[model samples]
Target: MKWMEKVEHMYDQFTVREQKILVTMVLVVVGFVFFMFAFFISDAFDERRERIRVLRETVTLLQKNRNLVQESRQAQASLELKAVQKPPMLQGHLDQIAKQYELSLNFTPQKPKDLGENQEYQVESVELKLHDAPIKNLMQFLDQIERGNYIMMITDIKLTTRRGQPDRMDPVLIVSSYYKRSAEELKALHDKAAEADKGKDKADMKESTKTTKDDL
Candidate 1:
């Protein structure tokens, strides 16, 4: 009680100017505390808002990627369906290629042996015994083999001078070129080829059917 009374007496003894100064100081301190709290809350909200913004952006990007993936899958499915409808025509195409390349196939075509469930063609050497030919023909033959559809490999080569030809040191080249199918590689190549041909045939059949139906 005595302390309270002394405090009241001291407050009463202060001049009006001192009293105004004391009130102002208390108000300023209270205002400072309020400002500090407001600043702290504002900073916290700002951080949370920034984090939300980043998460939203990440989600949007992921959604875009998902859409792109779906589109790619759809495109691939359509292409596969088309391929499945066509028929295989690689042999005819190979013949046409041979004609276009002007390559004369000296070897007889043989039925490729089925190496059991392996549909991939295997290349076996076709040996040839030839007298030497001119350098130009030899090079052309090699070039044709390189550019041909079937893999042609030269297994053996012998160079000899032409009989009755003088200065025969630059002898004519006799090459044994072997033509064979590609090595048996299980890469679904045969399946894909078959599917592509099937797709082409289906597409043609559908067109023909459409034409007949229209005529009717």
Candidate 2:
């Protein structure tokens, strides 16, 4: 209270113009302080908003990664379920299906090939030629093969119409079956091949040594 009364007493001593100038300066300083405070508050809010936006983006990315992982796991599970532990006898299976449809099939077994970069699976395929087969029977045969217990697919099919019999078709089919080999099985195969190679090398060395003894 005493300071306020003293500031009033000092203000009363100044001329009217000076008093007006002093009041204007005080108002400007107050306005500048308020503007600086408001600017800092606005900047703080903007920074917080930016942080929240970044956090939301991160959360969305994590959710997408989780979904991808789940999808991959599901696909792997489906593959494991469908893949057979042992290769199915593709020729016998095809013959069985053809019998069910009452269609005669000429079977030609294809060379089996290892699948995947790691050779963890093998594909066994068979080529079949059906002569003078009815279209309905052919369709049924194909359906049966596709719906069989083993993981089999009709990789290729070629149908040619008979010259005189419009209802009969000559169909050539290539069926492939997939089977998974366990790590132990693959290791055993590799070991067996290595042993064979070693045996061959030893035989060759002995033959060379015998020739050298004869020359001496």
Candidate 3:
């Protein structure tokens, strides 16, 4: 109270214009302090919003990765179920099915192929030629092969009707069966292939050297 009385006595000593100028200067300083407080509060709110946005994005990314992992696991499980421990004799299997359907067929066995980056599986395929076979019997033979206990699928089929007999067809079928391979088996196959490639490369080099010597 004593300080306020002294400030009033001092303000009464100044001219009206000076008093007005001092009051305006005080108001301006107060306004500047208020503006700075509001600016700091607004800046804090902006930082909080940015953090929330980043957290939401991280959660979304994690969920997507989880879904991808789940899908990969399911696909691997399905592949395991379908794959057999040993390769099936594709020609013999086809012959048995053809005999069951009372259809005569010729089989051409193809070379077995290793599949996948790790050589975890191998595929054995066979090509079958059926001449003048009844369509019904052929269909039954194909269905039996597809629905068999093994993982066999028809990769290709070409059917042509006999000149006059629409019910009889000459069909060529390509069937493939998948089987899993052990680590040792994969390594052996890899080594064999590598050796074969080395041999071929050596033969090619020898031939090239011979040709060059002959030219000289």
The digit string of per-residue lDDT tens for model 1 on 132-193 reads 34456445555654343333345455556666863331322222222222444345657677
lDDT at residue 99 of model 3 (Cα atoms) = 90
Best by TM-score: 2
Give the runs in model 2 whose Cα sits over 4 Å from its true position: 1-76
Query: How does model 2 score by TM-score?
Result: 0.62
- The whole-model C-alpha lDDT of candidate 3 against the native structure comes to 0.88
Candidate 1's C-alpha lDDT? 0.56
Candidate 2, overall lDDT? 0.88
Per-model TM-score, in order, reads 0.33, 0.62, 0.56
Candidate 2: tens digits of C-alpha lDDT, residues 115-189? 887777888888999999999988888988877445788999899999989999999989999988788878987
- Each model's C-alpha lDDT? 0.56, 0.88, 0.88
The superposed Cα distance between candidate 3 and the true structure at residue 30, in angstroms, equals 18
Ten-residue region with minimum lDDT total, candidate 1: 171-180
